[model samples]
Target: MAYKPPTRAGATVYVWSNYSLQERDRRWKAVRESGAKAGFDCIFVPLGDGIDARYLTQLRCSSVVLPTDGRPPIIIADRSSSNTWAPEPWQTSREWSEPMAEALLELGMERARIGVAGLKGGRVSHVTSIDGVVNHGAFAAVMRRLPNARFEEATDILGFARYIKSAEEIASMRKAVEIAEAGLAELAAAARSGVDAAALYARVMARMLELGAEYFPWALTLGMSDGSDAKRFTDPPLGRRLKANSLAQTEMIAVFGTQIAEEDQAVLLGPIPEAWKPVVARQREIFDEGVKLLTPGRSCAELLEFSKSVAEKGGMKAKVRLVGRGAGDDGPVIGAMTQPDALKELTVEKNTLWLWRPTVTGADGKTRFTWGGTVLVTEKDGELLSKRAHGAISVA
Candidate 1:
């Protein structure tokens, strides 16, 4: 599918901090519908964020959110404490925030209400940080710059944004999905009698790169591991080897343009595991049940109750918390509607996008087979984003 810009736009949003050129531009283009509504005239990409002001000037913009516009400034500083492997050094430099504030003020932004958002990725540690990224101090400094500014705390801003995808964002996600599909197809074809897990991952990742993915959003995980072991679903490269007849499960993301599309699939290398036969059947049953449960005007709590009943009937150790989630901004908005703190009530709105996964434990005491796919919740019905076959396990 060809990429189409969003019919809507954003408010005077500024990508004022340090981000790669591809990422910034992709984000800007994907949510054009929302940006247009917010009166998005120009996206002020700082010279430091790998964007050349001269090249940017040639593009369309209402006015550059730079310091020369000379008005009260509303500076926004973004920092995340998440599982990112690398520290974005450009963000930590003390002097970065001040200049951004000045530039916003100069560009006619009302300095009175600088807003900041802080995200802390899923962390079990008692006193802060995911994979070592933190920004409490950075956020505080931005607050000092604009005393009256308001702030919001989000565990995952991009994750939240992803749920509200514009047409452009949807197109980007679809493109990423295509690349992932192609790479995985290549991976399946290349599998041999005794391929190691590391070798398989390297091959798939290389294929993804060849298909235009700049980075792998998540590390590839392989083995006959169950869903319980799926906690570390994404892992960095390692020396894990694959068993001859083992089932290979991979959860990964393709970084294309500004969006990262997430994909997960499993393959039976030589012969299907006998233990997995019934498990796979149970997965299909649950998937159908979940899909049928998705109708407009249904409460999130109500659907969860129904899902729970279905899980119990199948003799699965089903937890509603692992159900469906929204997939938009950063990737998929993961959460079970059954949780007491459900992100949003059911009441599926037209055009709302969701990714739902239902899993069940096997007789062998592992989360062996599960199924999920991204779909659009329209007024009429549900439309799947990344289509996959139901009932049949993908055989290599």
Candidate 2:
């Protein structure tokens, strides 16, 4: 019997999860190198969405014990369904702790130095979290079981490795950008005085998933504010509809397979007040100038400072966070507010993906503007992946 690929109503669709074995090896090589450099014999990963778990084992929806010796990771899936998603010849279980410790012991790693992921905030710059996201019960269980093993913080082993995009990762990110643009286009076309903002968001989500977004990100940030308040994003009160003069915006993230791309979406429901036009224009100018600095080797601090100075000179305050990593797990999220010392010293690297959402608020504070896109840092320069904004989607 032949396995026929699934299709939707006689239409052609591209499968977005294709990554070559070599690409997988390339990622593994990075993890191995990072571990070896850190003197880690194994890395203990707990339950997470498709993060390092996906990068190393492809079955990280559960937990993983990745031996630094190039051996396949030992997995404990959150559900039995994970078994279907992982490649063959590997085993999965719903149990944790006992099974996990057993794998390390079997590998003669009970006394080996192990790196514990989620121990502290190393994924999105150690600045974002004073303490990393870790499951204490899981850690305690292992501590009790593997009494002789040593543990150390190992988040960077995966963080730095994920920062560099492989050829396949870039392709998937591009596709995610395409899917996001498709949704943005639909949202723009759907925007009008009478539509419900929530309804509009529903449409956007449907379209993205139809085009192959992995799932509906439940925590999507979207909002609509009517005149004078200048609130960029908010859920409309029940039964309220978009007024003729309104601003609808979203902090959108589109996921394709494990890759992601993000953008700031805005739709103007009516004409801007005469006084606000120049302020908006100046905001756009700041964005235009700031984005050019996305090239590799550019300093994150320098870019943020440039944005602040330009925005201030142009009559607005630059957003505290200018950009965020936009790939699997979306880490190293930088901003002055969270971790200033480290963010200011970071450098943008080639092939690193990002979502640049540069925003500014006018002197009155209510007159705000945002123009953003997902871009890839290339050897030559920053390549824009999203093509949805020419400022904001205007209905008037």
Candidate 3:
């Protein structure tokens, strides 16, 4: 059965993996309700984590449409053999630009305005570079195919839309937080003298999978430090054995049903150095102070200012590595200093999720301490998603 689209003025919206199908549906429904025809132009099938290939199959088969209205959304799948997933006989195959032009023409949108996923020299929405290239190529193809068609970059439109999570998305993210806590526990246990970075990573990852984590889109960064210097020399886990007095720091992300949670901590393998004790203590203070400011309606610029005060109180200079970002498929990154005005205007909405990490550089500039986690904005305050303690743990 062919899915029938809702009655509205038709517009083509481009999307990729980082944007979930649920998000796409929400956008389509909103557009339709506003008397606009909204259709999706998927740049390609995402093969790896976050997106399930079966969803692509359903989109190709027209078995499902926007989940909300059950309306068959006009979908233009990238049919280039290299761009698509495992091809099926029923799937419509076409060169990158050909199908886009065809879909618009079939919809009688040859001269109508269309939305592309990105603008030239703009922030990308997809997780992988492959999808980025596909998006850029699709844009070029559309311009070449229909010179009269109007093109608009809808990057921020889709980005801010994803900030407010639905109930279903919140549930999935809670599960992701649970898995991250479990993984952090395993990581703490595995951080010991004579343990190599590779072994630690393998053990924690295996435990996360064992505990029902679907996948991790990113790698766990594990590094070792001797406390003599502030710099943490990190590389791919290559069997470098940790010493008794070393500190192991790890930054990790665990995914549950495409929702992600982050865990970053330092574990003391042996007796804590006297000088390191105060640094760890101050890091905990900074984390607590920063998280306390994660209330609804608070802006990232406010958080950035708070971070500076926290660092000064902790006797260090605040080095804002990351302020916060959209946690799910729409990865809208908001840094502290780079885009301060944009950050100031963008207030945290209830049900929106963020990852905030505030770091402090020591007087020597070589040593640094950092802490943060996934935070969910609520009516009253920001909720820390991960149950793990905010401070570094003693593994020895």
Candidate 2 residue lDDT tens string, 1-396: 111222222322233435667776787778777887899998777654236666655543556677788887656544332332344312344345665566667667878999877677764533355566666776678788778888888887878888888888888888888887887788778878787867876777888898888763522233343335443333333454676767766666688757777777667777656655666677677666656887889877676566456646545565634555644445545444544465655788899887776666776766667667777888978888876556666786
The full ranking of all candidates by TM-score, starting with the best, is 2, 3, 1
Q: How many clashing residue pairs appear in each of the predictions shown?
A: 25, 3, 2
Candidate 3: tens digits of C-alpha lDDT, residues 1-396: 222222332232322233355654564455333223343332222112112222333232121112223334345332321112322211233233554455455555456655443242123134222233224554466578678766654333334444567776677778777887787788777777777767777788888888777555335434444435223333346756666756666666777645677767666676655556566667666667666777887766676566555546545566544434333344335444455544546666788787777666655554556666788878888888878766667777
Scored by Cα lDDT, where does model 1 land? 0.46
Query: Model 2 off-target regions past 4 Å?
Result: 1-17, 48-50, 81-94, 123-129, 218-238, 328-331, 336-339
Pairs that clash in candidate 3:
9-37, 230-367
Alpha-carbon runs more than 4 Å astray in model 3: 1-27, 31-71, 77-94, 120-134, 217-225, 228-236, 321-336, 362-367
* Top candidate when judged by TM-score against the true structure: 2
Task: Give the worst 10-residue stretch by lDDT in candidate 3.
Answer: 60-69
Off by over 4 Å in 1: 1-94, 107-111, 119-134, 148-162, 217-219, 224-237, 295-298, 319-338, 344-347, 364-367, 391-396
Clashes of 2: 3
User: Which candidate should be chosen as best, given lDDT against the real structure?
Assistant: 2
Name the better of 1 and 3 by TM-score.
3
Cα-based TM-score, every candidate: 0.64, 0.85, 0.74
